[model samples]
Target: MKILFLGDVVGRAGRDAIVARLPGLRRDLAADLVVLNAENASHGFGLAPDMARAFLEAGADVLTLGNHAWDRKEIVPYIEGEPRLIRPMNYPPGTPGRGATVVDLPGGRRALVLQVMARLFMEPLDDPFRAAQAELARHTLGASGSVQAIVVDIHGEATSEKQGFAHSFDGRVSLVAGTHTHVPTADHQVLEGGTAFISDAGMCGDYDSVIGMQKGGASIRFWRKVPSERLAPAEGEATICGVLVQTDDATGLATAIAPVRVGGRLSQALPS
Candidate 1:
C-alpha cells in the first residue's frame, strides 16, 4: 500500500495549496490512501467543515485533527456524521468524533488511520499509548488480515514522546508519523521493525514565517514575552510538506519512507 500523510494545514494558504496540488500528487505518486492533518486550517486554529469538505474532494481519504480539534464550534455536528474526519482517540470516551477509521480500498484491501495526542506539554487527555493499543487490538493487519496498512499519527510537542510511541508499536504498524511541531525534521527512515517514523511531517503552510505564522507578530511574542495580537497564517506561497510510505502487502510493514516538500521556501523533495 502507498500511503501519503500530510502535516497540519495552517489557513487559507495551506488549504489552497492542497486543493490545487493534492489531486496531481495523488495521481503522480499513485497513492492508495491520503491522510491530512487540518486542525489549523481555520485561521490557524480549528478546522471548518467547508475546509474539510474541500480537502476530501481534493483526494484526502481521511483527515486528522489535533489539540485544536474543537476550536471551531461548528465542527462538532459535522464530525458526528463524518467518519473520515477523526480527532485524537484518547479524548474522553464521549468525544464528538471517533479516533480511528477503516477505509476499504480497491481489491478488498483495507487501511486503518488513527491519531493520538501526546500529553507532555500538551493536553492531559487519556493515555494515548493505551488508547492506541486498545484500538489496534480490535483490528488485524497483513495481506490476509483485516487491514493491509495501519497509519498512526502521533500529534505531540515532544519528539522523545513521539519516538517512544512509534518504537513501542514499530512492528505492528505500517507508519507512525508525527505532527504539531510544524517544522520538518530530516530523519525520515524505516524502523528496524518495518514501521516508518519521522519526528514531524511539518506544516503545509508557508515556511517563510514562524512555523507558518506571520513573522512580525510571532517574533514579538518571543522578544516582548507578551501578547502581540493573535497569530495568523502567512499568506505567502505554501510549501506542502509530508511523507510518502510504501508498505509491504504481505506483512503490512513499511518498505520505504520518504519526505515530500514542494514549492514555497523549502528545497524540493519527491519520491523520484
Candidate 2:
C-alpha cells in the first residue's frame, strides 16, 4: 500500500497549494490513501467544517488534528460526526471527537489511522505511549483479517518525544509520522523493525513566513512578548510538505519512507 501523509495546512495559501497540486501528486506518487493534518488549516488555528470539507475534496482521505483541534468551537459537533476527521487520542476521556478511525481503502484494503499528542512541550493529557498501546491492542495489528496498514500521526512540539513514540511502535504499525511543529525534519527512514518514521513532516503553507505565519507579525510577538495582532499567512510561493510511505499488504510493514516537498524555496523532490 502507498500512503501520503501531509503535515499541517496553515491558511489560505496552504489550502490553495494543496488543492492546486494534490491530484497530480496522488497520481505521480501512486498513492492509495492520503492523510493530512488540518489542525491549522483555517487561518493557522483549528479547522472549520468548510475547510475540512475542502481538504477532503482536494484528495485528503482523512484529516488529523492536534493541540489546536478545539480552536474553532463550532467544529466540535462536526468533528464528532465526521468519521474521517480525527483528534488526539490522548485527549481527556470525555473529549468531543474520535482519536482514531478505520478507513477502507481501494481493493477492499483497510487502514487504521490514529492520532496522538505528546506531553513534552504540550498540554497535559493521557499518556500517549499507553494510549497507543491500548489502541494497537484493540486494533490487533498484523492480524489476518484486521486492517492492512496502520498509520499514526503524532502531533507535538518535541522531536525526542516523537522519536520515542516511533521506536515504541516499531514493527507494530506501518508508519509513525510527526506533525505540529510545521518544520520538516531531514531525517526520513524505515526503522529496523519496519516502521517508517519522521520527526516532523513540515507544513503546507508559505515558505517565506515564520513557521507559516507572517514573518513581520511573528517577529514582533517573539521580540516584544506583547500580544500582537492576529498572525496571517505569508504571501508568495506556497509548498506542500509531507512523507510518503510504501508498506506491504501481507505484513503491514513499511518497505520504504521518503520525504515529500513540493514548491517553495525548498528543493523539490517528486513523489514516488
Candidate 3:
C-alpha cells in the first residue's frame, strides 16, 4: 500500500497549494491513500467545514486536526457530521468527531487512521498512550486482522514525545508522523519494527516566516514579550511538506518511507 501524509495547512496559501497540487501529487506519487493535517487551514487557526470539504474534494482521503482543532467555533458542530475529518482522540471523552476512522481501500483492504496529542508543552489532554492502545485494541493490524494499514498522527510540541509515541506503536502500525511544530525534521526513516517515522513533516505553507506566521508580527512578539496584532499565515508561495510510505501488502508494515517537500522556499525532496 502507498500512503501520502501531508503536514498542517496554514491559510490561503496552504489551501490554494493543496487545491492546486494534490490531484497531481496523487497521480505522480501513485498514492493509494492520502491523509492531511488541516488544523491550521483557516487563517492559521482551526479548520472549517468548507475547508474540510475542499480538502476532501481536492484528493485528501482523510483530514486530521491538532491543538488548534477548535479554534473555529463552527467546527465543533461540523465535525460530528464529517467522518472523513477527525480531531485529536485524546480530547475529553465527549469531544466532537472521532479520534480514529477505518478507511476501506481498494481490493477490500482497509486502513485505520488515528491521531493523538501530547501533553508536554501543550494543552493537557487524555493520555495519548492509552488512547492509542484503545484504538489498536479495537483494530488489530497485520494479516490476522481486517486492517491492512495504520497511520497515526502525533500532534504536539516536543519531538521526544512524538518520537516516543511513534516507537510505542512501532510494529503495530504502518507509519507515524509528527505535526504541530510546522517545521520538518531531518529524521525520516523506517524503524526496525517496519513503522515509518518522521519527527515532523513541516507545514503546507510558506517557510519564509516564523512557523507559517507572517514575519513582521511574529518578529515583534518574539523580540518583545508583548502582544502584537493577531498572527496570520504567510501568504507567499507555499511548499507542500509531507512524507510517503510504502507498506508491505501482507504484514502492513512499512517497507520504505521518504520525505516529500516541494515548491516555495525549501529545496524539493521526494523518495527516489
User: Which lDDT tens digits does candidate 2 get at residues 24-137?
Assistant: 898889999899999988888889999988888988899999999999999999998999999999998898989999998878789999999999988999999999899999
Candidate 2 whole-model C-alpha lDDT, 0 to 1? 0.91
Q: Which RMSD values do the candidates have, in order?
A: 0.7, 1.1, 0.9
Worst 10 residues of 2 by lDDT: 138-147
Q: What overall lDDT goes with each candidate model?
A: 0.95, 0.91, 0.93
Off by over 4 Å in 2: none
Ranking by TM-score: 1, 3, 2
Clashing pairs in model 3, backbone N/Cα/C closer than 3 A = none
Using TM-score, give the best candidate's number.
1
Worst 10 residues of 1 by lDDT: 219-228
